[model samples]
Target: MTPARQKLLIVTRHTPLPWEDGAGAYLHDLARYLATDGFRVHILWLAPHDRLRWKKIWRLPAPFARAVRLHLPGALRLGRRFVFLAVVWLPFKARALDRVRRALNTVGLAPPRRHPSPAPPAAAPLWASPPTPAELALVVRFFEKHRPDVVITNYAWLCPILDLPALRRTCTACLTHDIGWQRAALSAPGIAPEITRDGEAAWLRRAALLVAISETDAAELAALAPAARVVVAPKACETRAPFAETTSRSLLFVGSDNAFNARGLDWFLREVWPRLLREVPDVSLHVCGSIDRLVTLCPDGVAFHGPVPDLAPCYRQAALVIVPLLQSTGLNIKLVEAAACGRAIVTTPAALPGAPFLRDAVAVAATPGEFAAAIRHLLDQPAVRAATAARALAAVRARLAPATCYGPLAALLRANAVARHDVARDLRVLHASGAHPPQP
Candidate 1:
């Protein structure tokens, strides 16, 4: 008889659909590729309280709507600040409420009223906190029913799942998108470096395998978790045909409302964009994605197209793509995507380390003046831009293709399963022989 297929469970912060950010996009590609590789895949994400339900609640009669809003969970009713208080403060201070409920029950003075479960919302946001007791119980029940062979946590913050009893016997992997502490430090200057580093190190130590999105990140994680198996698996993209030569002088910038993207774009607009406009009078910059909220100022010759569903039209209309990243960790997914789309790229050296092989295929500029010069040069020479784009397309296909990039990760997961089995067998032997297993 053929052996049963192994099950792979991915516990992530978000559902990898409607890919809005790099993390979501990476998870989507990974899930698709792993499914194609023949593993039965399942995703478990924290579903946040739904917002659309509230919108519908408002459509009811004023008295009913007021009642519904009053009875809604404080987080859903009140807003972000109240949500933070509910998730953080209320949990720690619930003992007093519990005492009150218990005293009322003892006196038989007030019976607890049962509230009907609200209808599910159309779309739920991802949960962004440590799992509560109720959520943890749900995950435990899921594991009991499904019995996954391998469990992969998508982010370092989600590493708390390793503490679950369901995962104790399973081969566990942590996919660190970047060094969390480093990214946190860069984004928030007030964060204590040592606290973040220690927290990250503790999380890394819990995983059987650690996967990094870049070589630099792998090295850093390996140093922190010397005992853990660390592997590099760069971001992958679907290969696309090269763009045809175009006279369009529009430049494209795509990113979400991330700290790095906001800071980089702010610098580019204030410093580099002015220089580019002066040099090339007709050149225009088209900014895409959910970046408009973070942008405080809009300059001339720049158009903001917030949260585009498709980027193909933007790529088709632009002569060149720019990634003026001043500070970033891990691989920039946009750079790889731009290369895959066959758009000529001009990015900073800081952004090019993840795809070092593409050094010759794209222009690298460090300073604002240098960035302006490269963009101007590409705009003036369509042939050079086309040639560079063609080279990028070839390089990305050869190196960053999904199959080629994810193959090692797939193999690593299999190897981890086998290793886990062997260790479990050895422990069973030790138990049968009345011998103690070695401790860490």
Candidate 2:
């Protein structure tokens, strides 16, 4: 007899083709691992018409570079400046303005786009910036046809249960990257309640399992959807990647243009960055990312390298990695990447949680003054910086290994409906055949 094939349909915000941003990288790694594990996989993601031509790029090394560029804030800072200039300088042609706005929206800036969004006549939309009916319908049909044994989606925004009702019957799992509704509520007031009502909250309640990257996040999910299954799926860094270090170094900060990251950078630049630059005049601050709202007009020593294929080189040369996040609810992947690169990290206590870093294990600082003072202190002491980097690397290796992080995820997912049915059927036959004897 032949063995049955195990099929999985992964519905994500972006197709898991290449490593781009956090969510895109998540899907990419999942698909690659699952495919290697002998599961038949179908990926569903949103891609612009322009990106369709480069579909093959997802399988190539170049896309990995694109992913880095997309996530880095420095590069994005430049783009925002141009957009700001366009908003002010460009003619107010409504149709042209709409096109520009849509294009900008797709870019995913930290701050909201300037132009008005095109929406059909309704009292209020389902989401803050809801997907179109056409987009949701396409997702529904794609999942239905695939008829996967397991259906995994990102979060409630892209995978509302009401929109894709068929997914309820399937073994559904969602990787809660961050509580979008929570972040919206925190960053943009009064927006969360509306988006949550449109089915985001209910979808979480119905999900077979919800995976949060941190304990802080899992707790938040519990508050929102009390009855749902939620698990903390910690984030990890890629341990092996090669690069060379340069002698002249500066403090490095990298993140995509999200309101959370932007807030962090704004604080750093406003409070911490100026002080650090003043102390170390020649020390260059390299801001590498796509979103450019904050990093534009960076000072003399501050060079904004829009985006790079590999951050390993930057990490190698960097004296310290700064994660100055004020408002966020999950593990910072950029910090993980820094650890994997063996760079000393200076971040607010809020940016890093449950890392065992505060008890002199790995992390430092809780305020801008302390953060700036720490960066300056580390720069003055080469030995301390080197030692800290070594310890940080060891901490990452021991705790944040990809295998260590994904192990819990795999176990939880395997216990879902599809895996349970498969296990039950096998056990039933074994019991019926009296293959097991009574224990003494």
Candidate 3:
């Protein structure tokens, strides 16, 4: 007998319509795969990244307009400041300091007469504003209209939409990229109690299921609500053709517009690459991604290919794929994709955390000097590169496949529906005893 089809509603801020970024690509693959498995999936995406384009398809009437109106002014105010800090503050500080130092050198100014560069300001406090009443109500209205049997959302920001006492009575799953309130609280030492207290914590505990992207992330959520069902689902990319290694002299780095990747690239370029270049004169670095700023800041010998739909060429033309990341909190999809393509990897400990590929096989580096040495060592030996490439591909095939990672996701969704029904009976008994007030 054929399996029964289930209806699902997926809510996300990003989904691949134009095949643009990582989140969109992941969502597209997920939706397609789920549909192929006999799911009737209806996706309600916010498409905040390309709002104008999405607006043309599903136009909202005036009632929905009034709901988002209250938060518009605050979002606009903070968003403007965010752009100024990123495009203006940080780069201006770097350039201004360079100019002042040059002037001091020309005038032969002593240390006492020279002024030091100012420290760049900290990143704007993340998620500083809570969702407006209008936004939350709009979500509830959308949910009622769709009346989905199951709901899956990517972030905790959608909590206000699904956290109603009545809504919690239904099946809800939160695919946590990161816990917004917890991240905000940790990123900023202290924030207003109103924003982080009952608001976010309540929504998290009420979630029927939580899907965490990494083990570390799962552990964090487990601590918050030990009884809540949770699953760890690692990110995966569709297999691409092997990147042919034509040169024993070039390295590759790729990412699009993430601050963490930008910092990672800067560290590699400034501290690691120069050391490798000294040992290998013909060494070339090819950058593929959408960060235009990195090109201007990159050294003279480096090459930049803005944005390529197919990343195979960048990997194909390399000696080895380099991941010199130090401080990112989640999985590095780039490292896994490179390994899947049978390319040799030289990465930092932070870059390969919980990754099985590096037990004794792939090269690991803890410092800039160590990373540089590893790159140099790999470049010099063809035999080591060949062996490393084979092992890297085998590890990814064994551990990083979608079926291996997402099994827990299916199990957790099933458990969430059961858990919600069980909890509802207990709540009713307590209310009847007058131990707690009835919730409507």
Say which candidate scores most in TM-score. Answer: 1
On lDDT, the leading prediction is 1
Off by over 4 Å in 3: 1-3, 14-25, 50-130, 178-203, 237-241, 293-296, 354-359, 414-440
Q: Report the poorest 10 consecutive residues by lDDT, candidate 2.
A: 67-76
Clashing pairs in 3: none
Judge candidate 1 at residue 17 and give its lDDT: 40
- What range of 10 consecutive residues in model 1 has the weakest lDDT sum? 63-72
Better of 1 and 3 by lDDT: 1
lDDT of 3: 0.64
TM-score of every model?
Answer: 0.78, 0.72, 0.69
What are the lDDT scores of the predictions, listed in order? 0.77, 0.63, 0.64
lDDT of 1 by residue, 1-440 (tens): 21255678877655344336777678767776776776677766555333322332322233222211111223333321123235555556687778888899898878577687798634432343344565566667778988878888877767778889778878898888888888878887875553378788887788889989988888999988899898888878787566666788899999888889999999999999888888898989999987887987789999999878678889888889999888888888899889898899999987877668788999999999999999988888878888999888898888888888888888888777767767778899999999998889
> Residue 318 deviation, candidate 3, in Å?
2.5
Residues 1-440 of candidate 2: C-alpha lDDT, one tens digit per residue: 21254566665544343323555556666555555444566665443222333232222354332322121101113431212223334455767777777877789744354776687554423333445566567667766666666767666665463346666455677777777766666676645354453256766765677878777788878877777788776666667742333355687878765777777777877887777777767676777775364455565677667546567678877888888888766677777677778777888776666454423544578777788788887777878877877777777777776667776666555556455556556677889998974466
